[model samples]
Target chain A: MKICVTATAEGLESSVDPHFGRCVYFLIVDDGSMDFESVPNESFSASGGAGIQAAQQVLNKGIDVLITGSLGPNAFPLISSENIEIYECATGSVSEAIASYKNGSLGRIEASNSPGKQGGKQRNGSSQKNN
Target chain B: MKIAIASGKGGTGKTTIAVNLAISLGNAQLLDCDVEEPNCNLFLRHDMEEFEDVTLPVPLVDKEKCDLCGDCANFCQYNAIASLPSGVMVFPKLCHGCGGCALVCPENAITENTRSIGIIERSADWSHVDLWQGLLHIGEPMASPVIHQLQEHISEDNNVAIIDSPPGTACPVIASLSGMDYCILVTEPTPFGLHDLKLAVDVVRQLGIPFGVLINRSDIGDSRVEEYCVSENIPILMKVPNNREIAVLYSKGIPFVTSLPGWNNRFVHMFANICEQLSTRAAE
Candidate 1:
């Protein structure tokens, strides 16, 4: 099974991006082989509907599961409709998050936890400070 | 003349100037293009009737004709349409109604469908001032479409048209300000007001519309706003001092121009000055 984690950087050592829609990279990992492909999220700077666009990219990648800090209202429905299970991990590196998922420690995100337009650095584990 | 009264900061008296100027001019059409929270009707005495329903054309995909080519999805800048492996889904709320999707669809699967976004209303009671207001439905993301429709309803018979544009230099403001003969930017003297006013000025200047500043509550803040105006070569059309009576009257939803004496002549003079400026520019 393939799993996608919203990451701040290109590697597994990168912290999980808090925002699913505006993440810098999507690290798609093959669960069995421990192999991975890093896809830069083009929709990170989209003015609107970044979540929907990001979700479409993930869906196109045939991702079986999604791991992110939070799902916005616009992106949650699109991801959920595709039957891709989403797990919430607001902290730690991408590898740690995947390990937690394997150990059944990450919480399942059944619905969107973030409000519309609260795209990045406003929720948990955001490195940027809100001025 | 089509004059848009816009302010970058909210509660800087855009509505106050719009309603008062419309009434003062007489034989004018006052269009409230601030659709999201249209409060012009609250301040004006009128029996408003529903003029027309405003709708946006969203895309409707025909599944049978759609080969899952993802052309429509790719064409949509809004990402409102998603072409999943299972099927294509169109999110109407996210759609900007640009109609690019339908044009891009090679299979001709995408069709235009109307969705009600807002409504326009006209005042039946007020004879001198034809008050037209646009009301956007709750949870509606786009206000520019509604503003575009509202401005389209400008009566040809009216001598002057005053548009109360929505706050901030965004899409909705552009929609309201576009194609206007002139724009009256209302602002206060505070630092916040001055900052936003600069932004609004940039928008109007970029749009190539002749605009002048009308400083509301002119007495409260520092003289930096005046200095900026003088340096920028922007005309300070009118200055309304901070008055306790005006605030009291506004709280009661009463237009101070009608309730207070001597204000009518001041508004009329301002209108005449604007016309003179327009004519001077035309002669040049």
Candidate 2:
């Protein structure tokens, strides 16, 4: 199984790149039992739409599961629409998050963990199209 | 007149000067454009009276109609739209809500949707000063929408509108200073202060707005800030000395101008001088 782990620091485990405009990180992990190559998340530095880029990277890799400490409103739905699974409340090292995902200890979150229900609106898998 | 109290750097007493100046000037309105971590409300002690949600128009793609031609993705200056072989994706945070993608889409697959990013709260202490604050949601990327909402509270009747801009010279800062009559760049006497001060000066100058500097903690650090001001011919409007008493008062949420006697009068003079300088420049 291939998994993408988003961590605060690089190389400890795959860490979710913190959004430049908003603060938060995601850890995505592949849960399938297949041998998969690990790809480090490319840092997207632009002020707007970093989440989309991150999601696309994960989706392109055919990542099945994401393990992270928190997810924000912007990237939360995009990942879900790609049929990727999200596991929240996993913390500490990236290895630990992966371990939790493998053991089914990581909790599934259908919605975002953003405070004040900020991410709730975007969880419906509707693609936000701003042309 | 719209008077913006801003510093190129943080912790330079921008909020300190803004809160006090609004209070002393009485009948003025204070707009805290520092939406990320708005702290002016902490000092004013005004009960928040009204709250309004702020959102930006992000794109919503109808997957059934999207041909994934990537035209919408190509049209986005920010690369917010991602076109894959099988589907189209929209990254809302990266989307500037320009609506250009929808305009150029041949299939007309893109539609506009609103996503709430923050909230603008309105409150007052009945002391004639009104407080309008923008609070950015924890994970939302765009802050300009909230800043725009806070701007709606700008009272034309108020003789002065003091805007406390965000720290950096980014989109949020630009949104705060847009259409302002005067921008007061606040800074301290330090190397970092000077570096950011120059960056901020470049931004304001590029925007073609009339501006000046107010040096806080003037007694400490190097005299480089003064040198820069002289070299740039930017007027040094006022200087607030670095004092422990002022620091303590600030931590306790007391406006230094009121807690320490005579500071309010200094601000009055400073504001008057700013107005006079602007007028003089206009006449010239």
Best by DockQ: 1
Q: Weakest 10 consecutive residues, lDDT, candidate 2 chain B?
A: B84-93
* lDDT value, residue B160 of candidate 2: 91
- What are the root-mean-square deviations of the candidates from the true structure over C-alphas? 4.0, 7.9
lDDT of 1 by residue, B205-274 (tens): 9999999999999999899889999999999999999999999999999889888999999999999999
Encode model 2's per-residue lDDT on A1-131: one tens digit a residue.
55766655544454443331232333443445533354544534543455556666666776667766566665677777777777774446666666666788877868756541233434211122111
- In model 1, the clashing pairs are none
Residue A15 in model 2: shift from native, Å?
A: 20
After superposition, candidate 2 runs with Cα above 4 Å error: A1-131
lDDT of each residue in B197-269, candidate 2, tens digit only: 9988998998888998999989999999999899989999888899999989988998887878898888899
